[model samples]
Target: MQSILKQKIIGIDFSDYSIELLCIEKGFWKPKIYAYSRCILPPGVLFDGAIQYPAALSGILKKMMLSAVPNFMKNGLCVFSLPDSQVFFHEFIMPAALGGKSLRQAILHEVRTKFPMKFDDLYYDFIVSGKNHDTQNILFFAAPDYILEKYIQTLLDAGLTPIAIDVESMSIGRSLLNSRDRRKDVLIADIGSRYTNIIVYNNYEVSGIHIIKEGGEKSTNRISEQLCIPKAEAEVIKKQIGLSFHGQESEVSEIVADDMKEIIREIKKIIQYYLHRKKITIDTIVLTGGCVLSPGVQKFFQSHFWQEVEVRNPFDKLRVQKNDEKNKRNVLFSNVIGLALRGLHTYPHLRGVNLLQKARSHS
Candidate 1:
């Protein structure tokens, strides 16, 4: 693949439990990390993506800005990922009779009606997937006014510029697209700490994106409850054992296995529904998440789903220096790496089906 020449972009991922801040400077063959830092939230502060204590989060961002990007804090361009619950994504259609200005008007009208929040209560954007034969099809997204404003305000309040708000699923999707060609229908599942987000791309167009509440935390809690162990111990055990059933605690393993079975059933149901409704077969399943690193997860998923499966790795798109063995091994940072690529694409782009915003931004 050809190299993309561009500048640096700072990416920040804020979670209820931890905040991950990273910066990527431009490179010809590969991107270089300028800075990285992670901070855990204080206990009783916040839970799963909700800002229970804005002041606490703001303070953390403030300290992180001072420590992580001390030299160039002010006016630095940054982007943030919102919690899955606070964001909404849906597909819609407009009449074939409408084109050009008429189409634009129709889309805006649909946005006005379809969005859950009032027009004044959110910062909205969308992607035009393509025309469904004749009618225009689009994917719409809206983040609550307060959710977006809080991030912008937190940045402004701290002397950093938050230039964009995006979905984490799309950020990672861009990296996957850059590295591989998904000629057929496929599902990309990103199982994070609090939620598992699934994005279905058929022929390079995003057909569906679903966010499920089950994730790593759920597994941890299940282990904690069934094994009669502390949360921290359960967490360690989760990573070490995962779905492996290799340990002597047969009873605990059975309980964990049961929980995993439930999750798999739910995911399978979602996939089946999409396949049947859309009349598209899923050619493959790609898993990306911190959990994928857990022992035996890959084999477990392949065995249960009966489909080809793999982890997300963006190394194929980067030209690595032969001496940088450590960086070459860090495949888990694929999502953040993709988020960093946004600034270096030599063009303004939005991943997934945001054709409207892409055209609007470039114009």
Candidate 2:
């Protein structure tokens, strides 16, 4: 029997609250999304991008194989995203002469000596971002080793081959940037349940990331706490009334706005500093994750920053394999879609790193 490997790739993005899957099968034409599934994860399964309960997560993954994914795609090779909140990204300049073993040795030593965290505890990867007369820009990323192991075990238990692990910011960059025109410098504001990642991508490669302490969920929590409403009800109210208002004052909008002010402040600071230092302006602001679906969020960003803002829609350009696929999709799958794209290795311009380098081998 021929195992489903190279031809089909599954990209998975799972957070504390949900799991999204996309399987793209490459053929002669554009990559076709053969199967896709999304399901809500139970509370306590993942806490802040780290798996809290491995056995339960494995069980949930197994259920997806039986129910969400198609029978043929249940055992294919897959790539996953490491959430932005858990990974640290840094860009450094190395001698243009360094290559092969010497480059690796230099990067290894750099990480060992510079970063505050212990090198042994991290699963890391790097890619050369660009080059100049004497220096090559190297982008380095690392995440907790135990967290990656948990994810690998869960995927394996669900019968999927885990090929590589990627950082959330790079995955977002891959999906959002067009393969043909990679010239745009983008500022991605990925607002998640607990944090918002302010990522800078120059020419389709991630250059920097800034993490805001609280994010979209904080707004929902504020509404729930102040109004004395249930969380479920609060989420619905926040989404419905998100930063939009008429001539009169809206209580829900006010509450949401009040909570979002801190995040916006931090965002402005990052954007200002980046532009000032680099003397390069961002072409667009792409909004993704939990906050994007809310009404007027995209407009709010544009009005505040005076820049082009797009509410993330990972499926906007791709050709869906099935008509039913549209109904099952959302903005949150941008990271996973990029992970699948990474496995395909189609785009000539995009640069990414694979953290799972010797832990698992694939043909």
Q: TM-score for every candidate vs. truth?
A: 0.84, 0.89
- Give me the candidate number with maximum TM-score: 2
CA lDDT for candidate 1: 0.66
Give the number of the best model, judged by lDDT.
2
Candidate 2: list runs displaced more than 4 Å: 1-7, 27-29, 69-72, 179-181, 246-249, 321-329, 346-351, 358-363
Model 1: runs farther than 4 Å from truth?
Answer: 1-7, 44-46, 65-75, 96-101, 111-116, 315-332, 347-363
Q: Write the per-residue lDDT of candidate 1 for residues 1-363, one digit (tens) a residue.
A: 122233345667776666767676656757765666567778655565556776767778777766764243334666667765677777777665665565656666776675545766666676666556677666677766766666667766666665566777777777676424457777888877777888888777777789877777777887888778899999888777776776485555565566556657877987898778878778778887777777677777888886677775664545544575435434455565666666555543343322224223311
Worst 10 residues of 2 by lDDT: 354-363
lDDT of each: 0.66, 0.75
Error of 1 at 107 (Å): 2.5
Clash list (residue pairs), candidate 2: none
